[model samples]
Target: MTAPEDDAAGALAGTPEEQRAALERWRLVLGEPGQSVLAGGQLSEAGAGRDAALDWLYGRDEDLERRGVRQPRHGGDGPSVVTTVDWLDDITTLFPKETIERLQRDAVERYEIHDVVTDPAVLARIEPNPTLLKAVLRTKHLMNPDVLLLARRIVEAVVRQLVEKLATEVRHAFSGARSRTASRFKVARNFDIRRTLRANLGRYRPEERKVYVETAYFVSRTRRHLDQWQVILLVDQSGSMTGSVIHSAVTAACLWGLPGVKTHLVAFDTAVVDLTADVDDPVELLMKVQLGGGTDIAKAVAYGAGLIEQPRRTILVLISDLYEGGSEHRLVRLVRDIAEQGTKVLCLAALDEDADPAFDRDMGRRLADAGAAVGAMTPGQLAAFVAEQVGR
Candidate 1:
């Protein structure tokens, strides 16, 4: 099985045999987790239709029952739901608390999530309704890239719901919302001695009320207006960020789904490819993208900056490994200029996709000084930041 490792080597080319061999090779990358899920009917059941060739992934083909399950196999019915669940868990951790609730709801209804997991209630609901199970299969993995481009369709139902919710929430919050006093700030204003003390007669003496208001003074919240903004997330399509790239791209797509917020995505390696239009169909966006090229942070950033005619309201997020094929200084200069232009510039040295260090510390520091903060952001943190930045 390991011998097939070479198959994942070449690009998306070659004959049937080579393609099959390549699928097998990439399948090897799945290791045990990949096998467990794929072996359990994930391919055809959850991974078919999009790209027929993608069906070749991980020994999963037409009839899963034919080969039989393997390695601690305990199948009461259907393949293991662990893979999809695990992916969901990862994505769950990437969103904010409010967003997570929304995501959970989306997963449950849109993906028919209850049916996909080995839960009895879900099985009962779908046992009578076949369409329910079909829906479940569609949204099994919203954040996994290895599932092949074809399998991505299953994610649309849930993703669309989630994206719409997030986009709408964020867009409305950013574009239409007026600054409201924060809860803490509200607490502060409400704690005026004259107001609270008047309500609480003998229960609160002047000193007591003073202590109360002063003690609660820590809640000095001010009105931090939710501002309207446009964000362009440029993801590095290089192999390193493959997992994160997929997740972030989907995140970017969801942003595009909303009104008001101008979300643009440009994936890069040696050359820059503006994926703004492709956000409408993430699968096509990804298919159109071919990973593995030299990193050119400057080119990618500069391209994004050019798209922003009005910089002050623009939020530019560069998700990359930070290696550069182009001149590092030019990239630094571009970042500085964008910051000077009043763009809310930020560079994520590496989106929480992979954990291989590929950034230039000196360059990262320079960008930081230019007002572009750099750090790794978990998916949830990224989501929260996006929401907060846009006033969601």
Candidate 2:
């Protein structure tokens, strides 16, 4: 009847049950540190399980040290502490599917907890997503034969999703544009209803309230006749470039064996490795990638250059952060030479879903001056660019 008390814990403006629920939500949000501030320090059975699950992941944050809050250690001298398996079980039981995924992702990516994917129990229980897939690629080497088998499921699932999505973009880009000239082939997809109606408008019958159609116009597909134009993707396999590396592999797979284009995938760190042989199987190619090392953009570029048969018919895409470790001068000179020789050079700083790139601006500028287009692009955008270039 009367207004309930409200404080830092939360507003207790409803029934007693609702009031307790509000307090528990606040407790989970504020974490272990807020227990002192809450009116009732005790948590319900479900509430305590949820709290332990949340703490298992977020409590590992080093920033808690600055706040003077010591995180509770699990599996110590305590009898009922949460281990990785226990945390997984607790979160999956107490939280929804989405929350469980976030927790699993945080454990693998944020906390560097390889056990999430390495342990058979945890790997089987976890959901397959892009973040988890990246983690699997990074740590699959650490996994034994049995664990690697489980991790492959994550790779295949994530790669299948990527291929399905990117395949549409590639199909649309290469589908060809409609031309004004009438096509001899009367395909339903290329039917131009607007042009057909306008072309036969003079034959409209007012009494029937319909136009007497004479000839149906079909839109002609206009595409350039390409002579085996090569698309060489030089990807940097540095730790920071993992996203780009993953996307590049998938993109190459999608672009593989297209009528007018030949796809080449090359991954590099300090050394260059031509992955074109395995480009068709992105999952295998990604598994073989070693994600951390010094970057040598020049060495990779030189290797890509050697693969070029006809300079005018090649498109060299260098996917990297542009932090050249080999020779900066040599890198710039190679790019300049390649661009001047009629090769379409595209220096992409990043090639993932998020086009936001972290690259060396000075180096990017020099590459631009060397006649290479320098910028970040999503996989879809890159597909469109390739379509346009090949069409030209």
Candidate 3:
């Protein structure tokens, strides 16, 4: 009997090897039901390992049960039970780097399989990425000292990547635009190519089609901030705001010790804790953060307001979902009072890479009405806003 021509088979229906590989891929995608139709009731040994690794993570999804797809059953001569470490091993060994990373992300983020990070064996094997870093933050309390030590490597690696990425944005925002006037200093980075070309245009030789420069124009770099300004970052440490907490720590670290800005990093749940001392070390700051509790945004905001050296020059960034566990009326009134006094109040719903925030819209609108800017922003965008405010 001729094999049925499904989309997978039809698209790659060439040699027998290509057809088999495509069908195996489709089998993996379709789960257990695709076995008989796509792979003819069997998969190669590597294919079986890959299938088991995927099933280990995706099989726990309750939606599959609701969709009438039964979870893949093991044992009774099938593959053995896939422990977290074993699954990690199988995926890292059987899949490519990209596929392995995706599987690892699903295991921790979508499945909430804490063992992926909590287990030292798995932590040692898994690649360090943002998703894994978040998982570590959420579950770090569950780890022993040894596992926590291993988890710190993931934190450091991921935080270093974030700092490198954000530091560039911070530098650009704070680095003043090139001045039009020429400078005596001859720094290579401050070289004004456009101004130099314009200035040396008189010496251009038509025969050689090259400009013979008698003088090189170098523009002096100006500092954006002239007066001292305080940046009070009141970050909510509720369970839902872990991503925000991570970004806030990194943002504070990037903003620390600028020419004219003093950064205060305060984390709040029911109570507020000042984390400014640790702001220079984001890896340490993030390690010290407690990521789950009832949110008291008003209390945090009040604490931040107290830290303002100059009300007119301060930028109070309240990073939370606005699900206030404290008095909502007090929060709105406080924000309005601060904004009215010339303080820049920014209520960030999210401060992560995606910036896709799920926050209380009504409360956000209420804060906006109170003169506080309510929106979601990534770390880079927040730096730019702060830079603009400081420059002004």
Candidate 4:
């Protein structure tokens, strides 16, 4: 057989169904690991699903060292990739001061940036690794399978900045409410329930029948309560806003941990699910979030508005593609009503990492009508927004 026929025969050697499985296995194992690898060499039938299959491969990884396999020149089973700050040397030049500072706060703790900063030997080796960036950007492929994953690492970086800043802000918020819990739980040494009950009973005759319920007989409240924060984050979780889910969820985790905040987080594509109750690991929380839902701004906003237990102290944030599947006017009307109640309402059309301003005009208009101030934001900018909203 000719080369093509030989290849075809090899592919079809097994039953037609098994052949298809073999073809998939070949693509998974023999797939192009990087653009540099694919474009530089090897032209074969196996290359047909290279990009799509590799996208799936990276999704299986739980961390960076795994997704883009690397080995340390120092000789260990560990990947070779450089993760130290000395390796990061001037990566800060790529971001704003605030972004850099935020990243440094988180990176410095788990990794030794302080040590790397002083080590000239380590710093000398620091250089831009396109391969690392490529892996970061291309992670979006796991969802939609349509989004170009290029430069996505930028988004992830910004998302981390937002989370770090929000963590600081929330810590401050919790601090500001400091000592209140201790004061609230302090024992009232002057407990005279019987005396108080007798005093109440005396005011009404036996026939008047003033029923005095004793507090000692009352059911105790559970300790499940946390300090109350009335916060609402309106995220446009559409296909266009794909990567922003990580940002919003991380922000949610910080806010969720606040000592006294009743926090509610809702991410929307076409529809929205109230993810307030689940903010444990941002990764796991997001894995539960699937894309491709149609945007229903009105429904989502209304649903969020309903989540506010205290209108006066509540903060409502709306993030979206603005390509809403409902009436903008009605949505804005709802926003206006929520705002009128003293709820702090904010709306953003697109939350991209180094993204442009894109939004649904009618829905934007409705958001404005609702008295919501809308804008385009990145995860870094979102930190300032969160800080301002929480007044931390």
Of 2 and 3, the candidate ranking higher by TM-score = 3
Q: TM-scores across all candidates?
A: 0.49, 0.82, 0.84, 0.46
The predicted structure with the larger TM-score, 1 or 4, is: 1
lDDT of 4 by residue, 190-229 (tens): 2344545755664655776775543422111122234355
Candidate 4 TM-score over all chains jointly? 0.46
Residue 210 lDDT (model 4): 70
In model 1, the runs with Cα more than 4 Å from the true position are 1-228, 353-358
Q: In candidate 1, which residue pairs get closer than 3 Å at backbone N, Cα or C atoms, i.e. clash? A: 50-150, 94-379, 94-380, 95-380, 138-154
C-alpha positional error of residue 337 in candidate 4 after TM-score superposition, expressed in Å? 1.4
Q: Which ten residues in a row have the lowest lDDT in candidate 4?
A: 216-225
CA error at residue 184 for candidate 3, angstroms = 18
Q: Which digits, one per residue and each the tens of the lDDT, describe model 1 over residues 266-334?
A: 888878888888887765665566667688888888789888866777889888867777898898888
List candidate 2 segments past 4 Å from native: 1-23, 36-38, 41-44, 71-77, 178-225
lDDT of each: 0.57, 0.88, 0.88, 0.55
User: Candidate 2: global Cα-lDDT?
Assistant: 0.88
* Residue pairs in clash, model 3: none
Error of 2 at 353 (Å): 1.1
Poorly placed runs, candidate 3 (over 4 Å):
1-4, 11-16, 39-41, 62-68, 71-79, 177-222
